[model samples]
Target: MPAQLVWFRRDLRVRDHPALVAAAEAGEVLPAFVLDPALERAGDARTAAMLTALEALHRATDGALVVRRGKPEEVIPALVAEAGAEAVHVSGETTPFGRARDRRVERSLDVPLVATGTPYAVSPGRVRKGDGGPFRVFTPFSRAWLEHGWRAPAELPSQHRWVRRVEGEAIPDAPEVEANLAWSAEEPALERWHEFLDGPIDDYDASRDRPDLDGTSRMSIALKLGAVHPRTLLADLDRVAPKRSKAAQRSLKRYQTELAWREFYADVVFHHPRSAWHDFTDALARIPYDEPGASFVAWQEGRTGFPMVDAGMRQLRAEGWMHNRVRMLAASFLTKDLHVWWGHGAQHFLDRLADGDIASNNHGWQWTAGTGTDASPYFRVFNPVLQGQRFDPTGDYVRRWVPELRHLEGKRVHEPWKADDGYAHDYPERILDHAAERQEALDRYEAAKG
Candidate 1:
């Protein structure tokens, strides 16, 4: 029997994995996952999430996951040689670093290196506008994306025939880098998807912005890890659409648009690779940033003294995730309130968020900082307290995450400092005056434009 090597990267699952299935067709498959030193150096919640997914994959595969720690360009060739594999197969990656690394691996390998099914349904740079250039804005891009539909999800191989008895290294335990943040493997992700489909997706449009309710699909991590394919979710939406009431259809459409945003950002990163680290608009590079110090530390630690902001940060630290609306508010606080660089905020988020992907996190940070395509205007700063009162009105979300403010009743939890003097024992005072900081940010933006 011919030997085939299958490399696993961000796509960790066996079911509906095109590369794994293709490799199995050639011969007895040797499934391998490399713990690249570069990834470990990135050190954040993303790395921890990868480790958790790998552990789950091992369990699912009956301990068949091969573990090697090195650069893929060198390691893959070595593995291919040792296993006597005829060819190697892998899913394509879209990130700048990943693209470059895959190219190097392809050149180094002697046999054919097959790359398939990118991290998205429609691969980035595949869809374009009239002039044959990439779509600079999202609305037109989303329209073009829908017109260009994706392939149906592939089926998993039913049987595995092992030709050689090769013992690979053990799968590493979840990293200790972000010990405070709790992240589960694939099982919870599946449950979350079912729960969203069963309840919140029908009411998504109305309640998504209202952080108090479970209004959004929390399956981003699963999607990112490929434990669940996007097609599965898309099919579910279609199945339930006809049965839903008018309001539910409207809400479901809004929810689907967010998924499009994920693809939109992915396409943006693929087309404008430099935007991954730099401003998408060169003119906005002149924006000033505050020195990283006390305020930055306080923001990361969730002691910002602003109830909504603090709650978001606390939830991130405790759960390895935050509500989508709160994510926007928290990001706006960093870039607009503190005038910190978006790159700084991006790094911090990458360190904490379990679902953090370079395409989404980096672009989302740039959008909040007013430096990306379709960015929020620099003047439209989010008011953290008002946001909490308006969205999380009952203070359920705030109390759950920021326990210090638990004793404060009703909407008063949003501004605990406004309560009686004895309330000082419960919550800290306002960290930074929002009005004053807003003006400072405006002046800085204006000065940069001038």
Candidate 2:
């Protein structure tokens, strides 16, 4: 039997993985992961998480997982020849970089490169409208996505026939970034999913907005590494939700909508590849952006003096992840308040976030920057102070990360400048007045729309 090359990119797990299953069906399988220099150099936190996930995939294949370092175009074809592989299979590529690489790899190959599945439940570029055009907005796309529906989780292969002829290198150790990496890997990821599905998933809608509460599934890192597929989560939700209370069922549905948002961004990025790096909307492109200076540095270092934004940025540095609500707040501060381009903040996020995806991270920043599909209007700036008090009513989220303000108790914690004696001696004063900056952002938006 001709051996099939299984090119592992994002999907790095053994269970419910489509590409691996298809390769197994065709013939003996050679599992390999190519570490692209671009991706490998991303950052210590993301690199560490990916290396850990690769380790899990390695163990799943009994150390037969091939780890090559090079461009996939150069690395894959040589491996295919060395192993005498008749076919190559992969989870379909969606990002522009991934797409270009796949096209090159396909061109260089003699055998057919079969794409079996994608990281998303409904892969981008597939979901469309009645006009056969991609859905630009999310609500209709989400409704259409549910109508389009995804397949049930694929069955895990019962056995493996490893064709380990071509030797591959060792998966590297976690890099020295000095930041804590979130999520150990596959087994831990699955464990987290099962644990979330058991209880907190019911209260997701309630606490998902509140960063202080233990309310979210924390499945992003898992989804990023493909330890557990969205279909698996959707399927498990189906199995367990039927017996759940109505409120719990609603929460499950709410959580599922979040999943749809992920797919929606993927769809958006797939259709408008240029939009990944530029504004999706033309008018917003003309908006004047300020050069990032000390203010931007302060934002990066979590010394912005806005409790919610500061806490969120610091949380990102400390945990390599931030709450969803906090992300919006931080993005708004950078783009709307500081007038720095959204791409700067997005790149910073990509550099840091373990779960960062080009689709979601870029589009999310565009959404806040008022430049993407169904974007927040430039006028509708987020009030970090109000946001902190509302979402983190007790101001615990801020105090948790911005410990300098720990002395200031309760709601008072959200506004340290409001302290009767000014900001606690160590903590910096408010970097930029939100009210002044809000007007500036609105004025700039008006001028740019001209």
Candidate 3:
């Protein structure tokens, strides 16, 4: 039987994989991954994580997973010819770059390039409004998404025959990163999902916002890399939690909505590809943005003196991941308090985040900056000090990443300047007065609108 080439992209796993199953059913399968130079633009943390996952996948496939380096349009055709594959199967890519890349590869291949599924629960453009046009806002989109439900997770192939005739390059070494990745493989991802389902998901609604607590599922990187599918998570949620209790049901629903938010952003990008970098709406089109300067450096280095903002930035530096709530606070501090362009902050995040996804990261930044779909009002400037005290109440979250402020116990850690020994350890002073900047940001918004 001729081999079917399975080209793994974001959808990396063997389980619940439509492309993999389709390839396996066709005949002997040759799994291949390409290390495209263009896609390596993400920072060291994402690079390291992707490499680690690729290594794990190699082992799982019993060393039959072929690793190659080059442009996919060229590399995939060569692999198909070498393997004598009939067709190349893949999980359909939704991003603008991905779609364009696929078209190039398809044009290059002699055999068919069949795309079976995508990295989404319901593929980006599947859930549309009654009029058949895309929904601009999230609430309506999410409602339509639920009404147009996703299929159950695809079943794993009953058997496998991996082709090893083709010679391939060794998986490259991962770049060094400070954050410790607990797990990057398919098995560990499933384990984490089950663990979250066992208990913590019940409190996700109320506790997800508290950065001081270990309250999040932290499956973002896994999802981003396709270590686990959203459908698998959704299936598990239905099987275990919804019937546990009323409160558990609410948490389950909240978690589901959060997942939907991911899909919603992807949908937005699918419809308006330019919005990936440009503002999704024109409300902030005229808003003047300051150039990144000394204050920008302090914000990035976690010395902004707004404990929550500093802690969030430092956490991102050390761990390559920041709490979701803190991510917004940090972004707000950069865009609003520093009066810098959201693009600058968004690019920094994409560079640092292990789970940096283009659609989600950029859109989330725009949302916080009040320039994207369903954005917060322009005047809703987040006060970093108050946000810290409110979300990081005990201030342990701030102390965790900002060691210099550890001396200030309890909530005082959030407002170190008020504490007697706040700057005794040489913690940097506030870069700019928050109240002054808040008004300045507002003025700029009004001026831009006028």
Candidate 4:
């Protein structure tokens, strides 16, 4: 029997998968995964998370998720020759590395490499403006996106006729990275999603900003690994919206906007591949960035002495994730206060985050640095102290992450230096005065404009 070869990458799950379905449409299906040594040897937090998720894929496919390590160019064609696959099938990749790998694989394969779907809900490059160009700003792009809606999720394949006796390397264990694995696999991922959808989703709008509270859906890692599909989530949202109270409906709408932002960044990277390594807006590129010196180390180690920035950094170290609001404050402190380049902060985040998506992580740093599309105002700096006070009103987030300030009471924990009983608990002093750095940042922006 002629077998269909399914080359799995980010889209790990079987249900709601177009590529898997397309591949299975042939006589028999051979599931395969390649460990690109270039990606695996990075030995970062994300690498471990991906391995954990791949384990779930192993179980899902009943040991048929073929694991091989090498250049995809060599491994894939060799697998095809051995399995005698009629065609190599995949959900096409969107990132620069992914695109390059796909091209090379297509060239080497004797049979056609059929691309049925992509990792994105609406594939990047599919939704563009009335003109042929991609949308730079988000609001118009979102409206167009709604108009250019994606198809319903593809049904899972009915049967699995595993073509046995295939020789490939064992699925390797996750690397022994210093960071702990946060989101393990699709099973736990689904539990978290269903829990969030059932209970806390109604409060997502009002409470997503508070780092201390579990107000937001912890689905990013799941989304990153394709443990669950965005279309599946969207369909659930539609099913529940009518039954929800008006307030809950508003909250769900707000949460939907957040998902759309993810797609927007993906689209942004798809059209402007250069933005991955360079500044999206050139106007601010002339500003000189400070060297990653002692101050940079302080920021990385959660010793910045600004409770909000420190707390977020500590949380990242502990959980391999940080709250969305806290991540912004942390990124802002790095770019605007420390005068370090956004790339430095972005790289550090990619090294740590379990949900470290290239498009979202890099563009998020750029957005905060005011160097990317729809940039935050260049002169606007996040006062880490005030951000802590405003978002984490009770100082719970600060105390939770920065245990050094646990002795302080209530929101006063946000400004430890100002406390009457100011406990000088071994926490480092604020690296640079916020006022001083804010002015310094503005001056550089002025110089860049001039």
Candidate 5:
């Protein structure tokens, strides 16, 4: 049988992987994973998670993963020649770098290079407005995306014939660089998804914003690594027996919308690749960036002195993740309060978050900075103390992540420095006054507009 090369990029799984299955069908499979220097140097928790996921895939396939460290354009052609492969199969990527890299590889390869849909239920850029233009707003885009739906999950291949003749290097024992935050990889990812389907998804709408509640799906890392395909989640949602309970349906819808947001951002990046580096709103390009200093360090170290902000930062540092509501608040604090450039904040998040996809991270920062399509208004800055008190009413979330504020108790934890006694010795004072900094952000926005 002719060997067919399966080039694994972001999609790393045995199940629901169309390209892998296709490669297996075509010929004896030679699974290859390129440890590209570009991705390695990116050196974030997400990259570490990818390496971990690759390890899991290696085990699942009985050590079939072929590890190569080079650019795909150069490495793929070399692999095809060495393996005598008939063709290359890959799950198509939507990011600008990915698209460009794939094009280069295709041109260099002597054999055919087949591509398939992404792990997402619907591929990015597939949904469009009635006028045949790409959508700039999410609501209409999501509506059309749902209407367009996607194919049902494919069955896992029972057996993949491996080609022993193909000589390749072994998978690395770990990521090239150490991860800044801790993260559970493939197995934990699967367990978390099952747990979410079992209970929390039912109460998602009512409790998701409540940091004290066990509410979110917590499957973002899995989604990012393709440990579990979005179809699996969509299938679970469809199977849910929608009862008259307002909370249940609302929660389910909200969870589904969050998935939509993931795809929405991916679509945004695919359509406007330049937004990866430049502002989505061309006029906002002039927005000033604050110099990195003590305030920025405080935000990164989780010593910002605002209970909710610190809690969110601590959660990210400890678990390689943060609650969705907290992500917004923390991001807003960086862009609007500290006056840091959103790109700097985005880099920090990418360095820590296990779920950090370039599409989501870049667009999320843009949304927080009010520079993306349908972004939060520049003048609407979140008050961290109020946000903490409202979302984490009992302060349990704060106490769990920011133990220094635990003794304060109740709503007071949100503003420990505001107590007549002032802050505890360990906890730092507020790095910058929110009201004053918020006004400065507005002034910057106004100046940029002029």
Candidate 6:
């Protein structure tokens, strides 16, 4: 059989991999990964997790996985020539950079560069309005996404052969990361998914908003790296829903919607690539923003004096991940309270987050900053104290991450300023008053609109 080169990017695992299945059916497959400088700008935690995942993939390929360091455009074609590959197969790319790089590689390749699937359950640009145009808002897009369901997970090839003629570099060592990274490889990610589906998924709807509990699936990095596909998760949800309780069913549905939000953001980026870095809309296009200075440093250091914001920031640096609810609250504090640009916060997140993706992280910041696809736009500022009290009611979440506030008991942790001994533990004073900053944020929004 002719040899084919399967260039793995975001999609790393072999199971439910459309490109891998297609390549296997066509010919003997050579699995290759390129350590492009462009894609290696992740923080220590993300880089460490990714390298670990690649090692797992290497073992899965029966020690035939090719790891090369260079631009994919140069590396892939060279591999094709060396292996005598008939064609190069890959899961399609959606992000602006990925799409452009793929196009360049396609143009440079001597043979066909066939694309079979994407990192998303539904590839960006697939779901559209009844009129065939892109959906501007999320609610409509999510409705259409559910209506336009995806295919069943792809089956593994019955019999496949590996092309091991070519040799490549060894996977490089990872930088030192302070936070703990749990199971990151394909098998481990799958194990975590099944565990969530069996138990925690039942209370996901109720507990997802709480930061104190391990209520989330923790599958963001898995999905981002394509250690597991969303299609597989969706299929499993369908299989287990009937056997589970109504609460589980509701939780499963909510989980599915969260996945939809990911896809929706990708679609928005596909349609408007500039939105990845700039404001999606003109809501805050000309808003006066303060430079990220001392206050910004305080926010990053988790010393913002707001226990909830401090806790979220501390959690981010410690774990390379933060609770989703806290992410929104932290973002709101930065943009609204400190008047810093959302991009600064987004960049910091991408640097530290193991599961960071441009579409989701940047757009999420934009959403909180009232500059993205949010329907209400600016003026909706989060009250850190209230948000902390509501979500982390017992203040356990704040106490867990913020050691200084651990001395404060119960809800007192959320509002240390109110307690006579609030600063007894040496926690920093509130950087700025939320009520005063809230009015300032609104005033800036009005000026920008005018």
- Residues 88-146, candidate 3, lDDT per residue (tens digit)? 99999999999999999999999999999899999999988888999889999999898
Candidate 6 Cα deviation (angstroms), residue 196 = 0.5
Q: How much is 174 displaced in model 5, in angstroms?
A: 2.7
lDDT: which candidate is best? 6
Report the CA-based lDDT of candidate 3 relative to the real structure: 0.90
**TM-score per model over all chains:** 0.95, 0.97, 0.99, 0.97, 0.93, 0.98
Q: Summing lDDT over every window of 10 consecutive residues in candidate 6, give the lowest-scoring window.
A: 371-380
- Comparison by TM-score, 1 against 5, better one: 1
Q: Write the residue-wise lDDT of candidate 5 on 1-450 in tens digits.
A: 889999988787777788888888878998888988888655456776787888888887788778888888999999999899999999998999889999999999989999977868899889888887888888988899899998877765676688666667766666444333222355666677777777777887788898778787777877887887888778777777464366677777888888998999889888999888678886578888889798898999999888899999988887778888899999999989988878888888888888887888888888888888788888889999889889999989998988777787788888876776546647788778889998998899899889
Off by over 4 Å in 1: 160-164, 176-184
Residue 147 miss distance in model 5 (angstroms)? 0.7
Q: Backbone clashes in each candidate structure, one number apiece?
A: 0, 0, 0, 0, 1, 0
lDDT of 2 at 262: 92
Poorly placed runs, candidate 5 (over 4 Å): 175-187, 242-246, 420-422
**Cα lDDT of all candidates, in order?**
0.82, 0.88, 0.90, 0.86, 0.82, 0.91
lDDT of 6: 0.91
Question: Taking the tens digit of each residue's C-alpha lDDT, what string does model 4 give over 24-113?
Answer: 777588899898988853436778888888988889888888889899999999999899899999998889988998999999989999
Against the true structure, what is every candidate's RMSD? 2.0, 1.4, 0.9, 1.4, 2.3, 1.2
Tens digits of lDDT, candidate 2, 324-344: 999999999999899999999
Best by TM-score: 3
What lDDT does candidate 1 reach at residue 101? 93
TM-score for predicted model 3 compared with the true structure: 0.99
lDDT of 4 at 427: 74
Error of model 6, residue 135, in angstroms: 1.1
Cα-based lDDT at residue 114, candidate 4: 93
